[model samples]
Target: MQDEKGILIVLSGPAGVGKGTVCNALREKNTGIEYSVSATTREPRAGEKDGVNYFFKTKLEFEKMIEDNRLLEWAKYVNNYYGTPIDPVLDTVNNGKDIILEIEVQGAKKVKERYPEGIFIFLMPPSLSELRTRITERGTETQDLINERMTVAQEELEMMEYYDYVVENDQVEYAVDRIRSIVTAEHCKRERLVEKYKQIVEVE
Candidate 1:
């Protein structure tokens, strides 16, 4: 049997669902996991560094990537484009380290189509009210933008049925543990590991 390939974990949900927090906690606990940083055409905000927060690119450069088919999945939001770069993710996965991608529902669906073996997990809030409160607590958006986000989030939440697992993130630590468990369980699938152990039981 060939060496086991790394798992590609695609996590998505509505805004304020704490996907980033859960992923960060998981990485903190397991240093071997890799998190794929998405490329974006949006300008970096204060304290955000290029390559660290996102691979910031100009509109023209982003369009070039789209034309070249370099992005696994790309989408326009507001006035800018955001996408998951294909090469980086493939490289990490090929090296036998799990790659976790936190993307929007649309991009996540596209990834599922492209990589059928990838694991798609949806992180949801305990309730819509709690989600709204969390968004407001961030205090980064204006009232008008916040309202728009809430509307968009409701629509996104409806797409959770498409995911392989729906994890309601009520507590940070608990959510992180659940996500880790899912990854561990997936790695233990008989279909993925059985062939390697077959020779051990064969009579000489």
Candidate 2:
């Protein structure tokens, strides 16, 4: 296996499907992949450190970055700027450290455009009703917002065909194991190791 260039894993799903939970669990279970940190223009909350928790920037700075095409994927949410820094992502992955991106469906699509070779995995809820319940249990949104999220989730599920794999987030441990297997399988693909073996053949 070529250890110089690593894999880019894009993990995405609709809201309330527990994509974050599964990603966190997977990170703990395996230390092989690095988590991509996002940059934001929002003010840092207590206990948050710059360049560690998030690369906090001023709104002006962020806009300048956008003007320079420095960000890989970015979106303005409720007047705050949030985006993935392009250089760090490419640098880390290209240096042989697998990086995982936990983003929404829309952002995942953008990453796919820029990096089509990435391993895109979609996390799905068991059912819509269960999805609604999960959203409600979070207590993060009102019933009306929950309804909106359910609608979005339904629409997002239809786009699953674009993904390389779909893992149901029914049981946390099971989902983590399934993702680990996917990573292992991806690394074993013939295409990924083809050139490495060719070099060995030529050397022999």
Candidate 3:
């Protein structure tokens, strides 16, 4: 049978919801899913390489990409541009390789508008109190910033209704298992394999 096109998995959630941790653990399991690297106009830090860590670009270059509609989803933050380049994602999936995009809720929404067929998974925290604790433990934000994040998180949580699946990130391993099961179930979906199977039947 012919291989089906891989699914685009969009994992997103509120700040401090452990989206990054869950993605890292999932990838470490050798699940055969590629991490989608985004392009950015921000200066690359030490040991970061182009096309590997990110597709580093100049402000002008990044603007051109936005104008050309070459990005699946783009966002501006602190005067820097960050976006997922559309070509790489299409290339990876068309080659029958699953790719996971760990992005913000807003960016994920933009991606959905363009690629509605993508598998959008929302990583949910156990509770708002736990989410606040997680952000506090990060130690990278001020009290005021933490408060702001909590507010934003509440809004993001409300957006979970837009996602296809919601995986609770109470434990990293458990979340990864749920995601893996979702991927397996998506692959086995009859609509995804029907055409290939029909070809096999015709051949027989």
Q: Compared with the true structure, what per-residue lDDT tens digits does model 3 show for residues 1-204?
A: 678999999999987999878988987899999999988898886677898868899999999999999999988753578799888899999999999998888889999999998999999999999999999997877898898888888888899999999999999999999999999999999998999999999999
Q: Please give the ranking of all candidate structures by lDDT, highest first, separated by commas.
A: 3, 1, 2
Task: Give the per-residue lDDT digits (tens) of candidate 1, residues 28-138.
Answer: 897477999999998776678888768999999999999999999988765678899999999988778899998888889899999989999999899999998998997
Tell me the lDDT of candidate 1. Answer: 0.86
Name the 10 consecutive residues with the lowest summed lDDT in model 2: 74-83
Ranking by TM-score: 1, 3, 2
Clashing pairs in 2: none
Q: In model 1, which residue pairs have backbone atoms overlapping below 3 Å?
A: none
Residue 148 displacement (Å), model 3 = 2.1
Residue pairs with clashing backbones, model 3: none
Report the C-alpha displacement of residue 135, candidate 2, in angstroms: 1.4
Candidate 2 off by > 4 Å: 1-4, 40-62, 76-82
Best by lDDT: 3
Per-prediction TM-score to the true structure, in the order listed: 0.92, 0.86, 0.89
lDDT of 2 by residue, 154-202 (tens): 8889999999999999999999899889988999999888888888898
The list of candidate 1 runs beyond 4 A from truth reads 198-204
lDDT of each model, Cα atoms only? 0.86, 0.85, 0.90
The candidate, 1 or 3, that scores higher on lDDT is: 3
State which candidate has the highest TM-score: 1
Error of 2 at 6 (Å): 0.6
